[model samples]
Target: MRHLIRAEWTKMRTVPGWPIALLLAVLATIGLGVFTAAGNHSSCGGATTVCPPPTTGPDGAAVDDHFYFVHRSLDGDGSITVRLTSMSGQRRLPDAVPGVRRVDTGLVPWAKAGVMIKDGTRPGASYAAVMATGTHGVRLQYDFTHDVAGSASRIGPGSPRWLRLVRTGRRITGYESPDGHRWISVGSTSLHGLPARVQIGLFAASPGALHVARADLGGSIETIRYSSTTARFDHVALEGAAAGGWRRTDVGATIDPDGSVHHPGAARASAGRYTVTGVGDIAPRVDGMAVEKTLSGLLVALLIMIVVAAGFVAAEYRTGLIRTTLATDPRPGRVLAAKAVVIAGATFAAGLAATAATLPIGTHVLRDNGNTVLPVSLLTDLRVVVGTGMLLALIAVLVLALAALLRRSSGAIAAGVALVLVPRILATTSVFPDDVARWLLRLTPAAGFAIQQSIPTYPQVTAHLVPQSGYYPLSPWAGLAVTAGWAVLALVLAVVALRRRDA
Candidate 1:
């Protein structure tokens, strides 16, 4: 087992052009991350990189980059002043009316840096403060240091009053340690009324800092020891439920509106505050935008990667190296597997590189357009990007299979290009309706690019418009599946041809 793993790992790591592949993967991952993290603003606004104070867009809607801002209390909440340094290079200002674009400092106490989520949202509201008794608005007296301005900022060394949330109804005695377990809490917050967005990190005062290194957010995979239904493991990979009917293995609690779940061992939540990371993808709190972009890019990037796959197998066939491969491996199936594995890995890694490289550029565009709403799970988004690259490797497999079956480099290249590229061109023209185009797009790279359509708010290359045309070209997963199906069908044909043809 050890030897097999080591051999595979070595081969996976040490391919001739592997370094370039890994570099590409990292670049693509980061690039996509920064782009989506900053909110793909170029798909958004004008010359402004980040939304300026009291800023409004051409759509007559004012855009704010920052989300949370509570006002200081009028009486008991005391006086609190919070200053935000512009890390986005430019900033967004808030306003009372959505269409009225004037940025007035007198209206917003925190200048152009605040957004009000209080009173179910009052006009021209900004700033957060913890009010003392007898106060109506949110406010905290005094200010902290703004010394730590970058991603790294340190708070405290004063009164370490922290807010913690905990579950006791039937969680796996779950506990999380932050900052490498330094600031540990076992039983923190008690579940109560109303769902809340509980977050712990850095807040700024005149003296406060934002020292953030490893923002570790983990969901417990508990053993389901009890349940209300016949627990099944065939649907998923689970180890925690070995001794019991453990309800939540990935997320916290899942319940139907009837106050029940697929099982009875399900845990309950406090208030309406859903445990997003603990729960499945119920909301945008855990966005897969980066994943969407990565997958879409992978579909496009795979078109480029087919060239590499062809170079390896098709060009080699042209140069007669494939005969040498047969001389060494003999078995067509084994050789095919080896080549496919190498190609898939290389393409996946290269996709990652593309994602990372695009980060700085994407970030610039996002901030310029004023869309800086980053999700909590940035790393997960990176994984999606990496997956897209892997999808390209699948594309390579199809290309390699065609190369082996035909044993003609030029013919295989032409077929591969036709399979991947032509549909995108067709989709962009007035050739088909949106849905019709989507189904037909499966014939080209556009199908795969559909993975990047996380939101319905993506551009349409198709000329004719429909009801949901502006939303998503195709669902991301569905698009990937379509592309995968094409690759698989091609591979199956290649296998059949290889088995029958004389080497």
Candidate 2:
């Protein structure tokens, strides 16, 4: 092993431009960190207000926008009648917050006549809405609807409008289009209680400028598909109408307006916190996994180290160099062992260097994003984190053994990619309930992330929650273990293959 380490190191050190690459990696990492530590980096697109925006800022500085498109689920017995006039949201600020004042960007030029949007509250609805004009609209508005000053706009070509309404956590998507396949995205959105039949359409005042086209509503995905492929509200969806295309029903209820009863107004009268059990998420979205990137890059450096070792091992095999190497060292196993050592030492050094280089850059990136990994970081918990990194390099050694066993670069890379890529792809869907997805995802090469998870089983809701999904989703640690297990299994397979196969 020591001989192998020496041989590998000698080969890597002699390689042209190798040192430069290592230097660049280290410099980039620390430079980014220093930059981030010096600058102000907050959440994207929003001004860097403190932790929370102040409630009583200068006038017009605060704007709370709630756009609503209301509807009622229709019964098979009758046309589904619905209204849309008002929408509002709780101020998202510090605990002791108060509203500054009210403002309105009332009814657009396109909405149908007689329907005016104003401050009104609907019983059971969470938000105060601005809906159709007049007495009927007032009758529907709940008390909270008053003083919810906000502007409204129709889905238009100019506005690039799209409506995404979420009522009781269920999302609805709708669009207008002359062609069924091509659809327009809606702009005004509403958050009503569950079992809502949200009525939305395009209308005009004075002389009708807009014309009706078509409308349809399912869950969210279908609506998105329609809009992505077409224009906005060109199909002519009206906000308040007796016989429109959209409606919501009880979970198990049939789409047809059978004898099922319609839900009362859109809000919950006395609100309670809602929780959905077994709907867990696997977070730490890929973008945030900086340490994971470090591990990967280090592993790459390690792989290059392995290739260096293998090159020495094959020196005799290449251009009669192995013959001369064997003649000089004489002991086949001992010579091979020495080569392995050189490779391991060099690779581990390179790996460590790569890791050290990334740390500063990763720190800066996180800081610039106004986010920091917490509870722990790689520096504080180097054992587990470094262990993961070393494990990756060891994987490289095992692969190098196979390369020595195979002696062909194309064969090695092909075999490696073939083994690793599919598994990683499958693992992304690891949270899926399908048995195959679970079995397949767990068997990926990059399984170390299981340890990095901040939370186990992050709260994730499913698009469709059916009973027969599969073996339950694994906890984050368990999921990571699944990946590690695959790695161990692969190493074992390589070991056994090496022992059995001829070089």
lDDT at 308, model 2: 49
Model 1 scores what on Cα lDDT? 0.38
Off by over 4 Å in 2: 1-8, 17-47, 51-316, 328-331, 371-384, 429-437, 448-503
Off by over 4 Å in 1: 1-119, 122-301, 369-380, 428-431, 442-446, 456-474
Report the lDDT tens digits of candidate 1 across residue range 11-90: 54666564554455455455545545455543436753434333222221222222222121121111111111121111
lDDT of each: 0.38, 0.34
lDDT of 2: 0.34
Superposition TM-score, candidate 1 onto the true structure:
0.45
How many backbone overlaps does candidate 2 show?
A: 63
The 10 consecutive residues of candidate 2 with the worst lDDT sum are 222-231
lDDT of 2 by residue, 1-503 (tens): 45545664666578654555545433443454444444535564124642332111111111122122223332111121122222211111222335544223222121221111221212123322222221121111222212221234332333322222212222333222223344343323333443333332221111111122222221111110000001112222233233543332121111236765322112111122111111001111111223333233432443344344445444435565655555665555555555545545454555555555555556545444554332233343464345444544444554555555566644554554445444443444323334444455445544443443332231211122111111224544565555455544544554455445422
Which candidate wins on lDDT? 1
List TM-score per model, in order.
0.45, 0.40
